[model samples]
Target: MRAIVHEEKEGLEGLKVKEMPERQISDNEVRVKVHTAGMNRRDLAVVTKRHKADDPALIPGSDASGIVETVGGNVTKFQPGDEVIVNPGLGWQENSDAPPEGFEIVGLPDHGTFAEYYTCTEDHLERKPEHLSFEEAGVLPLAALTAYRALFTRGNLEAGQTVMLPGIGSGVLTFCLKYAKAIGARVIVTSRSESKQKEALNLGADLAISTEEDWQEALASEQVDLLIETIGNATFNKSLGVVRKGGTIVTFGSTTEDEVTFNIRQFFYGQYNLLGSTMGSAEELREMLGFISDHKIKPQLDKIFTMDQYKEAFEYIQESKNFGKIAIKVR
Candidate 1:
């Protein structure tokens, strides 16, 4: 099998496609022939050394869709030729207030899906939605699951409510907009690129604004019921200003920078809710797939790269050139 391997010596420069040994399955695991793999911001972090990996020859990818090629003795959920998508989050099986101890994401310590073949526990695989292509399903796992947990599970988002989504072009944020709109919610999005703002409007956003402009002033009269804050310090305080009193702010990532400072008095006086979330449970991933199938929602794919073009794919994402998910075709 050929896989994308990243080492500490050269960081991102060290990333390369190399022949590797095939994965072996355990009693409760299955081996999959990867068709397509999705790239995330975390992939970039790992390659850049911002996020450290315990393994020296780490295969860096979390989202993927493929066909089951073999199953272990105890694996009964799937068999050969069954199409499946990998659930990146390990542990945290059911709904809970928080993830259980020993929870970890795939693609770090464990080898990931960026290869010709990968293996995982049977419990971590789900049937791919019938409507989505391999490339679309590849990108849906991590981003869609994250958005589903942030918007519905933690934020308690409901139809007819207003949502403010900052950084509209990323995979998760784009999923948020589509999911919210499908549920009849009014969505307002912000992006630094004018073209992205325009694209958001076409994707069912009620309004789109420039992140560079005075967004608070533009939305002065509209009180957002739920604000999904992923930009961190750069937009956290401003998000507080646009949200309605007693509204909720659910944060998942700090793309700009972590450790934001906000007024303590304002937070208490306004009686607002501040919540933090990460990748969701396996149950949520299954539910998210059903929701996509039910609503007939398709993930927006920005570009597809061959396995050999992995470096160009990484560069495209690092430069923020994509409006949606970037996929790597493995087969």
Candidate 2:
């Protein structure tokens, strides 16, 4: 099978597509021929030093849409030729406040989807939403699940309330905007790119501001019930300034600086809730699929790249040029 492999010899260099041996499925596992694999920020971090590169040789991607080729003898939920999308977050089956001890992302120590063929336990596969194409569903799992958990589970986002997103370019933020709008929430977003700001407006954002402008002044009169922050130290302090008193702020990724310092007195004085979230649990992933199906929300696809253009695809994302999810055609 052809796969995107990262090695230590290159030590933080980009991934390259190469031949790899296919793994035989275990008794409870299923094998799928990947149709389209979704790329995320972490996928880029896997090949870079932003995240830990634990394995010298690894296939690094957590999202994919594919067709089941073969199932283990014990598997009962699915059979050959089934269209499915993978739930990239493993373990944490129950809807606890945090991921359990066994939780880990799909593509670190173990091989991930960015290949012609991929295999995982039957538990990881979910039937792809019928309304979505392989490319759309390929980008659905990780971003949608994370957004669901961040908005609903952690931030307690409700309809008729205002939700603010610090950055609008990534897949998770795009999903958050779609979900919030589907539920009738007023959405506000900030982006440095004029095109991204306009795109967010088309996607149902009530207000889109340029990050270069003063957020506190621009949104001072608006009531921010919930704020989702992903840019980390770069915008977290500014996010605090815009969120309403007693509002909730949910944070996931640290795309910028890792360490952040904010005034402690202002936090307690304002009675604000600062919640941290990562990927969703299995239960939330299930619910997110239903939500997508019910709302008919389609993924905002930025671009699709063929296997040969993997390098350009990686570079495109690393440069922060994508406005939505990036899909890799594995077929």
Candidate 3:
């Protein structure tokens, strides 16, 4: 199989197209012929992170939508020719507050979907959303699952409330905007890009502002019941003042500074509930696919690159040029 391998070198220098022996499915696994694979920030992490690079030349991708070519005898959920998407987060089947001890994402230690063929455990596969194309569904799993868990499970968001999504261009934030609006919630978003702000409004966000604007001052009239914070140090403190009293703030990623300083007095005084979240559980992944089907919500696609163009795609994402997920088409 042709796979994009992440070699020992750091960053984009390590990415190369190579022939790798395709693994045959075990009795419990299904072999999928990957049509499209989506890129995440963690795909880059696989090459740069020391632990991941320690075992060089691993297939590094977490999101893919493909057709089941063969299913092992023990697999009953799918058949040959079934369209499926992978739940990048392995282990942790039940819906819970946190991932279980054995949990890990798809692309690091285990080989991932960045190949012509991918092997998926039966439990980690879900039928693709009917409303989406392979390109769209390919990017939906990771981002949509994270957004669903962060908003519904962790944040306990409800309709008739306002939810703030800082850094609107991310794939997860775009999913949050769509899901929140579908439930009749007022969605507010911020982005450094003017075009992204306008795009968020088109996507039914009630309010869209520049990240440069004062968070509290710009949203003075809005009472944010839930806040989804993705950008870390640069805007975390500013987002603090935007949420209403007793509001929930769920953070999944800290792209900027890992450690942030905030006023503990202000946090307690406002009765804020701060929570951390990661990728989601299997049940949540299924529910997220159903939600996308119900709302007819398609993932916001930024760019499409061919299998050979993997390096350019990685470079594009590294520069943060995409407003949504970037996919690499294999077929």
lDDT for 51 (candidate 3)? 35
- Model 2: residue 222 alpha-carbon error in angstroms: 0.7
- lDDT for each residue of candidate 3 in 87-117, tens digit (9 for 90 to 100): 8989989988788998999987889999999
The global C-alpha lDDT for each of the candidates, from Candidate 1 onward, is 0.91, 0.90, 0.89
How many clashes in candidate 2? 0
Clashes of 1: 0
Error of model 2, residue 318, in angstroms: 0.6
CA error at residue 101 for candidate 2, angstroms: 0.7
Models sorted by TM-score, best on top: 1, 3, 2
* Cα lDDT, model 2, residue 271: 99
Winner on lDDT between 1 and 3 is 1
Tens digit of per-residue lDDT, candidate 2, span 1-331: 9998887544336467799999889989999999999999898877776344454578889999999999999999999999999999988787897899989998886889989998988988999999999999998899999999999989888889999987798999999999999999999999999999999998889999998789888987899999999998989899999888899899989989989999999999999999999898888999999999999999999999998888888989998999999999998
Instruction: Quote the lDDT for 313 in model 2.
Output: 89
How would you order the candidates by lDDT, starting with the best?
1, 2, 3
> Lowest-scoring 10 consecutive residues by lDDT in candidate 3?
47-56
Question: Number of backbone collisions per candidate, in order?
Answer: 0, 0, 0
Which pairs of residues collide in model 1?
none
Per lDDT, the best of the predicted structures is 1
Reference-based lDDT, residue 227, model 2:
94
